[model samples]
Target: MKAVAIQSFGSPSGLAVIDLPVPAPADGQVLIATEAIGVGGVDVLIRSGALADYGFAEGHIPGSEVAGTVTAVGDGVDTSWIGRRVWAFTGVGGGYVEQAVAPVDEVLPLPAGLSAVDAVTLGSSGVVAHFALAHAHFAPGESVLVRGAAGSIGVTTVQLAARGGAGAVAVTTSSAERGDRLRKLGATHVLDRSGEGDADAPPGYDVIVDIVAGADLPSFFARLNPNGRMVAVGMVGGPPPADFGMTMMAAFRKSMSFATFSADTVPVSDRRAVRAGQFAAAGRGELEMVVHELLPLDQAVSAHRKMDAGEVFGRIVLTP
Candidate 1:
């Protein structure tokens, strides 16, 4: 089998494809013939050695999510899963390959009407947004804001909030064209990074999904309604919000809350439910799974380059 491994740490050039023996599934695992692999920000961090605590040494394979077909099952697994189309969380890495093995527990049958590419591209983002929104406890008719709204997770969060009956959906994007696109996809308003909404509301947002945590965070946090909360899910804005303490103190009178979300904190059963629901919503045409680019597995380096340059508006998928 062929797999792309981190030839070394640092740049996209570090990624190189190499031939490796097919991995045999162990107990409670299944081998998937890879079809598509999703690229994530964490993968980029790992490649650059910025996330050392979560990374492996050179020559490591890096992929956490994949969509493909089960070719074989390991001990304690059902044979019925064989030949079944599925997408899975491949532990931490090992997905930038032709064949990847994932735990049976992490594998979900690809629901009808969702393509393998769509699932692979949107799966992780959907799951993350679902949980983040749940943690924020957003309600119908409440106003919501999503930072980096043009990104994959932001797009999903925006649509899901709309589906949940949010009265207002504000997204932050630098491009006016992208903002217009998001408006068609259910965003009630799109603002530039300077925090200008299409319209003003003094009462402010009830829930904020912030992917960009920077100096601008405090201003957004200040916009939350009384007793409302903000979830910092990504760090695209370069740094953790400066004056975070001052920001919290400013919102203290209203009892506003601030927290971060990690998919690891979500239970497997709940994750399964979110994944299934997202798949269904997408199948019904309620949620759009955006694929900004699709490249062959061997073009992994080029894909990484695009992501690093922030040129990707949605998920970038690699097909094997």
Candidate 2:
């Protein structure tokens, strides 16, 4: 098997491809012959050492989701899983390889017509977006603003909010071109990167799904309407300031609230159900799958560079 590993942790160039013996699935696990791998924001964080405190070290594989065919099943697993097309979660690492192993509970059969690329792109992101909307108690006909809505999770959020009957779906993107792309995905309004103060929404948004949490996060909280809820899911721009809670308190009079959400808190069965439903929706064309680009497995370094540079507008899939 060929795997990409982090030789060092500061730059994308640190990722190196090397030959390794194929790994066997452990009890309750299945081995997959990966056909597509999803390059996500977390992969960049792991490569840049931003997640070092979380135990990501040199030699880490740096990928979480992949889709392919199951070739082998370990004890306690159903033999029928073998020869089936499926999407698998390889924990925090071990997915940037030709072959990977995942727990049976972490694997899901692909919808009848879903391609490997689409499966990997929507596998985990769709679940996060769905759970985030549920967490914030988003209501139909409510207005939604997806801060930094260019990545996979952000893209999924925009589409889901629209399909769920949001009266207005606004997105903050880097340029008009990207905003135009998002508009096609059901975004009703496109605002500049500093979207919190956009003139289009003087009344404020009812819900905000923030994927970029940085020094500028406090500004977005000020744009929330009465009873508005904001969920922070990713901090790709960096962590918020220490006094960010003060900003939330300042808006307390309006009954606005802010929270950080992680899909890990959702029950495994619930997450799986949502994932399967999303996959079916995508297969039926009720949802869109945004894949920015596809690259060969050995180009893992280049893929991370593009993601770190903010050049990728959607999920990047790597073919093995």
Would you list the C-alpha lDDT of every candidate in the order shown?
0.86, 0.92
By TM-score, the best candidate is 2
Worst 10 residues of 2 by lDDT: 195-204
The sequence of per-residue lDDT tens digits that candidate 1 reaches over residues 249-281 is 965789999999989999899899888887887
After TM-score superposition, the amount by which residue 29's alpha carbon in candidate 1 deviates from its true location, in angstroms, is: 0.4
Residue 12 miss distance in model 1 (angstroms): 1.9
Error of 2 at 249 (Å): 1.8
Quote the positional error of residue 157 for candidate 2 in Å: 0.5
Question: What TM-score, computed on C-alpha atoms, does each candidate reach?
Answer: 0.94, 0.98
